[model samples]
Target chain A: MKIINFILFPFLFSISTFAAPTWYPMPAEAYKFGQLYPKAQQLLFAFDYGHALVYERLLQNRGLITDPKEFEKKILDAVMKILKNPPTVKVDEDDIAPLYVYTFPLMVDTFDWSHMLHQFVLDVLATSKDRGPAMNRRVNELFIDYKKNKPLAITDVCKTMLFMDGQFFSKDFRRQYPSFNLLIWSYHWFQIKLYEALLKPTKAERDIAVDQVTNDFWTLISDLPDSADFDMMPETRKEAPNFYKAFPLISASFDNNHMLHDIVSDILASKKVPSSEMRKNGIDFARMAMDPEAFKSNNCGAE
Target chain B: MKFLALAVLLCSQMLFANQKAILVNASPNAQFYRDLILKVRQSGEFTLPIPGAQSSLTYSFDFDQPVFPETLMGDIHDSFNPIYFFRSFWDKILFKDGSYLLINGEKLPLTCLFVSGQDNRFSDKKLLSPLLPEFVLKVYLVANDFSCQGPVKPGWPATGGREENWDTYLYYEIKDPTIMLPMDAKLRYRWNEYSLVLVDRGSK
Candidate 1:
């Protein structure tokens, strides 16, 4: 019996030992980024957190915050602070604060989506060198479509616009005040604009162009800290700068439409008692603001 | 009693003395002309050009589904490239000479061909084809900077040591095509940073 057991044991062990081998071809040392060009990968990672923070704050305070506009303001202010000081490491599961647990899942999901979108942008830019204007225009169209189709009122538009309006107002006031809708729009616009700038000219030229745009973007944000409305205003082709001339109308329309979406989302998301019993007043407002014909005609010109 | 045992052993050995060769041609027509003949020669198990043998051996090939990482489907929207995201966890074997063996004039997928090398006489019969030997070659595509030695093993799982350092056993048999004679072959492969060594059984 012991002899039989020994023979069977060796056979069983031999059968179990035949495991497949694995290989890791790419190593960590191969991954490197030069200092001159911005680290788009790292920036995209940071942007992910900024978007999450706003979304979490919005969802957590959804019912508690009585005033939608006021909530938007606070969230936008938070976004501005994040842009000013982005986090270093990726947000881990444990890093989610107690107040943000409810919205954390949604934020995590959106981060995945945003990361894919960032990759898509990189792929598109990498492929087309000379079509900067067309690509930028296409990106703008995609953003508009995203807003109209799958709009996230609190995070996508409001916080984005606030981040873009960094240099316009005093840093303190900008940090204090939040305009959630405008922040989303402005951030997206700047991101797309950066892509456009990077796609054109010689490497040196592109670098200079991005620096100038970055400076201009910061300056514009700094000048108008309280409101993104001024930033969204239309300028004649002659008055506008070289790159801005190509899509002045579209840019202006996007800014205003985004703000309108923000206000509507705020109203819908807010806890204030509605004048009407029907829960769709905010939706109705969004539809009116998002109307393409009205947008072409500058219907929200007064605001 | 000893004479009886010896007679029984001699009879058994004589019964298995007749050997048969069956060819499985899986190579492309272009490569077949060049490689098939060479492989047979290098294998040293069989002789070619039997009087009654068919011109080409028949075989079929089938592919198995690739194994992917468990996290792939859920994380489709993540930034990482989906192709390299999953580790390669499986190996598939295909006939070097891309063809299937004909058993009684019917082609069968090349899964495992059972061959008896004890037969001393060669037969064209499809059932009498000898089994082909198999070799397991362990390989690691090491990164440039990393080394096979020291505290950090170059090609190892983060928490575990080198996978190639693990023990593996290979079983093979060599046979004389003219007369059935089984030559037992055992082998093992050990890989370090520079190259892989294919060692015979019992060699450290």
Candidate 2:
């Protein structure tokens, strides 16, 4: 009995040693930063839920693209309901999967890496002291540090737009999934605009900017397929040109992140690949086809 | 002129950079605490096992350089990692596992910790991010009756800037000059104060 147990220990140890994937998280304080940008945070929260639902819907047998009616019934209608009443908190992504590991095992981590930076910039703005010192310096400093963090970092801006424009990827997903696509574009619009708003001097002012952005989100989202928001994903460089001017890498990184999100959805909705491999293949397409490891972006008022 | 401004900045940092820590021996009931410390080391995944908590803790990587982020907002860990100590002390406990004091139901003297770090660099490249110019967190395992050998001594007067206290508070000191990356001037590097500590302000 002892000999049998001893021999089995090695095998058990090797199997047990298999490492599990983990989420990339923002600094603890980033969560507290939500207080300053409640609406944007809520939208960000909704985006988390939206990602899971959209992915799960795409995984549905034959999905909507195969039968346009089911797509409207299952995907479009649900998004409209969500727009009317959004979630208040960022969701626990683990519960979203009816089937554990439905998306690529790394999907949650990949989103989390970009999400952490998203919140990190918010925290920098949120933490700025009134009239104490310029925050740009610190914001810029932290941005550089954030990129240095890997396994915890999603890629920065890709040099090319072809990844989002390729055969497997294009406007088809959004064209088909308008409401959900609009919802995601709404998330990016405010997320990018908030950077511009954060450059405001005070939280009260920032609060007002957030409200305006929120209103802008609703205005655009309500316009449906013809909405102005659907024209293009929010370009950080164009929307918050000063921020983009200062920290092109982080701005580009964030823009790339949103672009990839859309691109991956396109790949999934197209259903060219097997449902099981959709997410895995999509992630591969994102990293390999669109390499943004070189440029991360963020801007504190100073260097 | 620049020297004077720099001096004031440094002086102010010296006065307030107090990341005080309390190292309680792992008593019998605290066996879980001891084992956890042993499991995490030299900067890996860290989640403080706040009993009955539903979420994990995350580090903000304080960016103020010599200063740390706010650790506690009240009775909660505002934004900081759990006890980070040196890897060398992974097996250096002095108390029997599971032996700890309970004061009003709160576990006394939490698990031992050792932070390895260095002087905050002022160079342009090094100043990019918090994690860029920082060290790692290690754990210390000791048996019962093991008092902390780290810079922070129990019941030391607060804010005096003693050699041991300041060094521990700021997280620096050299045990081995040869192997200096971990030490490079970092031991007990500044971390957010995750727990509340009562200040004794000299009898009012």
Candidate 3:
């Protein structure tokens, strides 16, 4: 009896201590639109990898320099090649940025899940013929599923830019790497604009608008710091008003995700943040991003 | 004593119920699966290889479904999971850990392996999504034991059998002509390269 008790106690303890892995399977309809617009999908995939590469380089201090322009030329050149010939599928970020992934898996997971939501919305728009209420209903369902994994979900509540820029280490990444910063904003600009393009009534219009948007995106980043949207990160409300009016929750979530992206870059690039504290800071900021109470009291709808 | 035994049985059953894989079943929930398949067909993303093979392989993707992380990985490694195979996770570990898979009774020799990629550009001129059938399959017999050696781990079978190869590569894919996702997708089996197609058991 005593021997059995000892063995059982240890077995149960081991089982209890193990952290169960959790992930949600994407809906079947999600990847259908990806087929229709392979180019757009590929670019999105490239953007995903670009984000990882920047974070990894910043955090690992790999080829990092004091001069932002030199660093941008080097990194952006590599990134441009990827954009030219982007991957067909999702890039395993950990492979590209192991330290970043393992250091802040939660934050990384949050971003990945939000990215999935981004794809979900695209799928909803691309697949559904009925662009009005039916599309909204499907997107609403996807949003619910997006929120299923609470730890991985970014809050839909709109937080002001102050939450992002107010921190001590907030604007350092952008200030130091202005061109590189603009490049990321350009990526965000295209992401939101694609939704606007997809919102066009006809497939012909959508195709032309998407191409125009893609061309515009390239134009925006052509000269780097000079032509970029340096005034602010692309807000979904302004860049994609149709999408915003249709689904404020998803739009806010995208806005929050973009905000988190900046916050993460700032944390990684800030010299004020100790190397060891970067992960902690990243996680702390992620929690603040996920906090619903951080919503605008009356100014929520202002932005 | 009887009450205690019944109580324990009920508790275990409840736990088992919670872990059950949500797949094709005769429940009303099956409607969700039907709608998905319809959407796939409507989008022209996938189709049955044979017109009458409706029962071939159907998958229900409940995005909100709670799945144990290992279960997802297990589906990929099981060699018989289903129509869709995600290889992104496996590719990361494949070179480091080495992989062994049994497809159509052939025990893949673990040596230097290079899985050949399909040409995404087709004569139809339509660019297909990488998440389709062909892209999903990772088991092209390009060069087995070709100029490379992988680390062999201990307690790994000195003998042969499907069960013994614990680190099996994810296998199985849609029979429809077009598909590919960089690393995540299905395993398409070529009859000339191998024999027999195994339905993904995980889908059941």
- Judging by TM-score against the true structure, name the best candidate: 3
Measured over the true interface residues after superposition, the C-alpha RMSD of each candidate is 30.7, 25.0, 20.1
lDDT of 1 by residue, A1-303 (tens): 232233223322232111111112311211121123344433433454444455445443445555545655555555565556543223321122222322223322233333333444444444435566776655455444434434321123112233223212213222323444445544555555565565565767666766775665555456334544544523222223433445544444444443443443344344442425213443444443434433243232232
Across A134-202, the per-residue lDDT of candidate 2 in tens digits comes to 566666666666666565455554445555665554777777777667767777877888788877777
lDDT of 3 by residue, B1-204 (tens): 999999998887665444333321212232332222222211111112333543222221112211122211122211222222222211111122233334334545432222222221221212233432222223322113332222233344654333222232232222222122222223333322111222211100
Model 2 residue B167 CA deviation in Å: 59
The best candidate in terms of lDDT: 3
The TM-scores of all predictions, comma-separated, are 0.33, 0.51, 0.60
lDDT of 1 at A165: 31
Model 1, span B1-204: residue lDDT tens? 999999997876554332100111211232221221122211111112235753322223332221221111111111221111111111212232333334235443333111111111111221111111111112111111111132234456865865443222122332222111112222222331111111111101
Q: Is candidate 2 or candidate 3 better by DockQ?
A: 3
**What lDDT tens digits, residue by residue, belong to model 2 across residues B1-204?**
999999997876554333213311221122332333233322211122245663222211111111112111111111222122111112233333343333224333223334332211111221223222222222222112235454454455554444343222212222211111112111122333232111111100
Tens digit of per-residue lDDT, candidate 3, span A1-303: 232233223322222111322234657677666777888888887887688877876765633455666666777777777787777655456535555776676778788778877887887788788968887898899899889888878888888888788888888888888888898999999989988898888889988988898889889988888988569888999989988888888888899999989988888888888877877887888888888777443466564
TM-score of the second chain in candidate 1? 0.17
Q: What is the lDDT of residue B197 in candidate 2?
A: 14
What clash count goes with each model?
52, 38, 18
For residue A302, give model 2's deviation from the true position in Å: 22
By descending DockQ, how would the candidates be arranged? 3, 2, 1
